[model samples]
Target: MSPATQAMQREDTQNPAMLWIANGQQLWHTAPKDSNGKSCAACHSDAKESMRSKAAGFPRFSAPAGKVITLSQQINQCRSNAQQAAALPQESAELLALEAYVALQSRGLPVSPSRDPQTRQAAARGQKLFTTRIGQLNLSCAQCHDNNAGKRLAGALIPQGHANAYPIYRLEWQGVGSLQRRLRNCMSGVRAEVPPYGAPDLVDLEAYLAQRAQGMPMETPGVRP
Candidate 1:
């Protein structure tokens, strides 16, 4: 295998985010009284059976929302509607674990984000967002991750903005987070005020990232520096 791919593999094995995934597995089977006394397993059966190869497609256009939605958003929706559980705050351990578990189901599947009309439009918007300068730094995501990918910035190698692997354990964050959350971190890095989770702009950006990684295999539960 090429060095970069080999390095990425090594990173995954060493990722601490796997611990959160393990936690999520435990949570999934734990019954909650507030959830109508139901466990996630009740409706989903086995996580492998119900969710296998499912997370490979994300940032999907939700007809109900009239916009693209990330995998994390969908998990929250499921918690509210299917599991009868209260929606946890975004970036919480409960949400992260659930997302990690779902993402793991699609491990090794190719990212197949939609090409539907809505998604296409969202992707277009996202591309613009990627290149547009935002925040106090007046820098775009491409400024580092794209234009200077593989180069060093303050002692870190800039990745090529690949979102195929997500629900990753980031050493910096010291926890698991979604690609969208990472996008927000970039916005913050540039001193830009981040939009709310599930915000249209962020959703579009996710759609664009997933579409860019069209044929890339899903590496959910990835570990990143």
Candidate 2:
């Protein structure tokens, strides 16, 4: 990103993602409509205290789900199991807002994906997917993110493809988006078959990314051009 874009992210007032974060804060304290469901705050209490460093350890095994899941998935699980509410749809404004709000609590903390067997296995599958060629272009994620990182592609810089900064305010999208959205964009760019949102494959890839980005500081609500 350019200096100006970086500055936009660093300053909360200038960051567009702050809007989502604010909405998320409101939702955290707001009860579900048409139901006796409790607000997120009712169960978790103060997010700053209860959710601190929580985002760092995502893409972990969920005993209830019996699989590895992302932060967003976990949030939905909490809503369903604890709040007795319906799970929010992927990439929905409300969901993204909640995710952004939760992720914000872990900003500047190190990425710390679980080392459990199931998570590790998912990461292994993701690693294989990362290296395997696919799509009309016959390209792999490693080709651009690993081999050609820092190189120019269609007038844009090819980043190292880290998952540290997410739920970012992408100028291209004109809104906050999740890592899975970004992955879908890449698949489309490569002319590959795009998977549906919340697919296990995407979650597995996220687990791999989390492991790859381990120890990197979280940069939720990041801005990207």
Task: Flag clash pairs in model 2.
Answer: none
Q: What is the per-residue lDDT of model 1 for residues 1-225, given as tens digits with 9 covering 90 to 100?
A: 246544754575555777888888988898655687778897788999888877887878776556677777887677777767787888888888988988888888898888788888989999999999999989998898789998888887788988987888776777778777888888988999999877889888988888889989887777676
Pick out the ten consecutive residues of candidate 2 with the lowest summed lDDT: 30-39
Candidates' C-alpha lDDT: 0.81, 0.93
* TM-score (C-alpha) between model 2 and the true structure: 0.98
After superposition, the stretches of candidate 1 with alpha carbons farther than 4 Å from their true spots are 1-14, 64-66
Clashing pairs in 1: none
For candidate 1, the TM-score is 0.89
lDDT of 2 by residue, 5-79 (tens): 999999999999999999999999998783366999999999999999999999899999998899999999988
